[model samples]
Every structure is written in C-alpha cells, then in structure tokens.
Target: MSATPNDPSTPNTPNTPNTPSTPDASYLVDGLRFAFGTLTVVPVRVTRWDREAARGGMLWAPLVGVAVGAAAALCGVVLLALGAGAPLAAVCSVAVPAALTRGLHLDGLADTADGLGSGKPAEDALQIMKRSDIGPFGVVTLVFVLLGQVAALAQAYGDSWARGALAAVVAATAGRLALTSAAPAPVPAAPAPRAPS
Candidate 1:
C-alpha cells in the first residue's frame, strides 16, 4: 500500500521521475464546506463558533453542502447553456464528482443503516459494519437515497447548476458526517488498577 520513490506516480512523493499530478481545484474547494471531518475541504471563510468537541480538524463540512448546492446551481445553468437535454446534463453533471469520490458516501450510508439499524446488540451491530455483506436496510436506503439525489438534480436543472452541485456535495458530506458523529470515539486506554496484596 505504500508508495515508494521508485514509483513516479506517487502523490506528494519526492525523488520520483514523474511530476505529481495536481488534484482538481474544485474538488479541493468543494471539500472545505464542512464543520467536521477533514476529507472534503471547501473553504468558505465564514465564521464558525468554537465547537465543544474535536471538530476543529473539519470546519468545512457544512460549507461543502452549501458549496455543493451552489455547484448544482452552476451545473444547471451550464447544462441549460449547452442546450443538451435536461436528462443528459443532469447525469453528466454529477458523474465526474461522484466517480472521483468513488461513491464513498453511498457505501457509508449503506453501512450505517445496516450496522446501526440491525436488530442486534451494540456489539453485534458493530460486527455487521465489519462484514462486506449488504442487508435489507442498506438496500432500501441506497435505493431511496440515489433516487432522491436524481430527483434533486432534475429539480435543480433549470436553475444554477454550480450552486446545485455544491449543495449536493454538502448534503452527501453532511449526512455521512452525521453518521460519523453518531459513533463514540474509542475510549482511552484504561490504567490498570493496582493489585492489592
């Protein structure tokens, strides 16, 4: 899994034959729109009140949603400008971004539903997430979520597509982040109690 100097394609890697590829600026820009989890970094420069938890690493998550919405609006306009039918534009608009992220949020969404919604104890629930198998909950959720996304894209088609895309990204990021926030952080290693004589 480790990239080495021998491989020219390694990202941010030094001493390589190939120049590092530049990440898509819009992707980077869209990522900063979050309040937690630093994966998506769409920077908005808006003031955020200090959070009580360890939410500092990701201050852009919410902004991603806002940005996605904005992106969606932009996409809509561009689609309209291209004069391509609404269906084509809507499909193409989201294809690149979704492909880039590799549908990570969709997987997470499925896993959360399967693991948390399963009628089992907490330990068993945790076990489900580790398994690769999908359950009824994951399937149902995936279907409806994708449907909702498509519907949203269609609805926002006539308007600003850029803003709409940004909004969609934000929605996806925020939903997953909420899933993340629901889980408890691993407990600190407990100090061993001294054995009494």
Candidate 2:
C-alpha cells in the first residue's frame, strides 16, 4: 500500500516535522573511505564498519567510481596518444579497472553466471557459487563479456579516443551509482524490551 500523508514513517514530506536526517561530516568521510577501500585498490583506511557507516559507504560508492573511471580513462587516453591501436587502447582501459579492483566485479559476474546456469535449488546454487573453481558457464560468460567490453571500447576509440575516455568515465560512474541505488536503506534500531514486572 502507498504511504499516507499522515504516516509517521513517510520521509521528507512537506508536512512531516521529523524527516530523516543526513549523516554527520565525520560519518560522511568515514563512509567515503569505506567505499574507496572496499571497492578499489586505492589504500584507504576505514575504521567504521557499523550499520551507519555501511549506509554511508553505500551512498558514497558511486563517488569512488569517479576515481576508478578517471584512472581507467587515463590509461586508454595515454595508450592512444602513445601510438597504440584502438584495440590496444580498449584492452588497457578494461585491464586498468580489473587490476585496480582486483577483478572483484568480474568474479561476482562469474559467480552469478555459475549460480544461474546451475539451474539448481537455492542452496545448491549458493554452494555452486561458493566453490573457488569457475564452471563452464562462468568461463563462457567472462570470456564473452570481457571480449564485448574490449570490442565496444575499440569501436568507440576508433570513432574518437576522447569520446572513448568520456564513455569510460560515464560507464564507471553509472555502474557504481547503480550499486549505490540498489543498496538497502538502513533500518531503524528496535527498542529494548522492558523488564518483567
């Protein structure tokens, strides 16, 4: 059911006197640190891993993408300027992110493919994904997806290297923004139970 105007939980309503508050400055910084540390090879120290910090981190994930994408775009631009072919430039663009992120997203994609391809029950699918080894499905998906990325970027670079770089930035930022958007909102804490009489 849709929330009513009178609902106490409805946030940011014009009439609602108590809307949800934003994270403090310190928490915001912590969140950004967590996002960078978790998502990239950039060495950032994140001391807070609590729920609040997690929400902050999730909110900040897309910002980390800006840095990642810029770095990747730089690699491609530099390669192209150094007399590298479009294909080579594309390869470097893709490789830069994989190296920086330690192939974390690629591994996730593989695991997801394995799980879906198994056509098993949830538990079995989870087990299949948990295994360290990549199955046929994972291998196929990774190969094709990586190839597709390279091909697309190669085409883009052929059109204009600057456009390819800009595309890289946009793609990376949008991908991370998707992660942030998909993150579950933080739930309020439950009150402690009253002592028995």
Candidate 3:
C-alpha cells in the first residue's frame, strides 16, 4: 500500500494543505548554523544549530574586535620573527586586523564621516554616504586616519610590538563595543538615494 497525500514522508511531491511545514525547517536555524560555523568555527556547533547565517551574525562587535586584533598581532609576530622588512611588517600588522574584521568598521567610519562632514541637511548627508564616490571631507578623513595608524604603529617601537598587539586587542574591542552601546537610534531598512555631493 502507498502513503496518501497526508503522509509527509513522501518525496518529490508538492506540499499541499494536507501537509504542513516541519518544525525542524526554518531560516533562523540555517542562519544560526552558518553564523556559528563562520565566527566560532566550530563545525560541530554549526550542525547542532542551523539556518544561512550570513554577516557572521555576531552577537557583539567587541568579541569580534578582540579576535581580529589577536589575529593581527599573530600576523605581526610572524612577519617580524621571519625577518620581513620593516615596511612589510608594518603593512601586514595593519592589514591583519582590517582584513580579519572584513572592514565593516572602516566602512562605518567612512560613512559616518561622509554624512557628518557634509554641511547639508541630515537626509542629504546620509545620501552622500550612500553614493559610491567620496567627497573632499572623506578624502581628508581617510588621510588622517591612515596617518594616525602609521604614527601609532611607528611609535609602538620594537619592544612594544607586543604592546601594540595588546593595544589593538584593547582598542578595537573597546571602541567598537562603546560605539555599539552608544547607538540609541534604530536602523532604517532603506534610505533614499541622492546625488553625490
């Protein structure tokens, strides 16, 4: 005897009113699995809890920051210990954290600068940020940011590479967490597009 339309175990048949979605199937489950797999890298946990977890779906930016910073420090150590050139070490040190975090904070910095830098109304400022191009204010801010990082790394000195590593851990985590805590406003789903400033 064959199972009727009421039988959910059947395969390749279009689900109808008779059969309901399974409790186990869900987007949230898939997302959670993906997030755990990407962030914590625990393959076991990924399978344990699932649903297409994109963005790494981190619960806290500070944890992400500390992890990124530690990774950067390790990269720095590798370069320095391997006798890589000073420039190479410096570049790698900076890049490790930047790349590890996938540059979200930097984008935040750039956008915030763009929005606030524009003298126009708040809506217009936000529009400037959505655009692909950067304004003069953006360029200036980027330069200063680069310079400041370079200066900080340089000032960290040979003996302080370890401290630089610690600082990275402390600074990124503390700063990101602080920003997150301070953000009282709710995020809008989408913003109106506007011409570049």
Q: Name the candidate that leads on TM-score.
A: 2
How accurate locally, in lDDT, is each candidate? 0.55, 0.83, 0.58
Between candidates 1 and 2, the one scoring higher on lDDT is 2
Q: Candidate 1: where is the Cα deviation over 4 Å?
A: 1-54, 64-76, 93-97, 159-197
lDDT of 1 at 131: 77
Cα lDDT tens digits, model 1, 95-153, are: 54454345666677798899878988866887787678889999999888777766667
Worst 10 residues of 1 by lDDT: 48-57
Q: Taking the tens digit of each residue's C-alpha lDDT, what string does model 2 give over 1-197?
A: 87753254566554443222544577788788888888998888988776556678888888888888889899999999999999999999999889989899999999989998999987788778888889999999999999999998899889998889987888788989988887875343233567999
Q: Tell me the TM-score of model 1.
A: 0.51
List clashing residue pairs in candidate 3. Answer: 29-50, 29-51, 30-50, 30-51, 30-52, 31-51, 31-52, 31-53
Clashes of each: 53, 0, 8
Clash pairs (backbone) in predicted model 2: none
Residue-wise C-alpha lDDT for candidate 3, range 1-197, written one tens digit per residue: 87654344655233432222432243345444554345443452554331112322333445656776677667766777787644555566677766655565566677778888888887788778888776777778877886677567645535466766666567667765664465445577346567799
Weakest 10 consecutive residues of candidate 3 by summed lDDT: 48-57
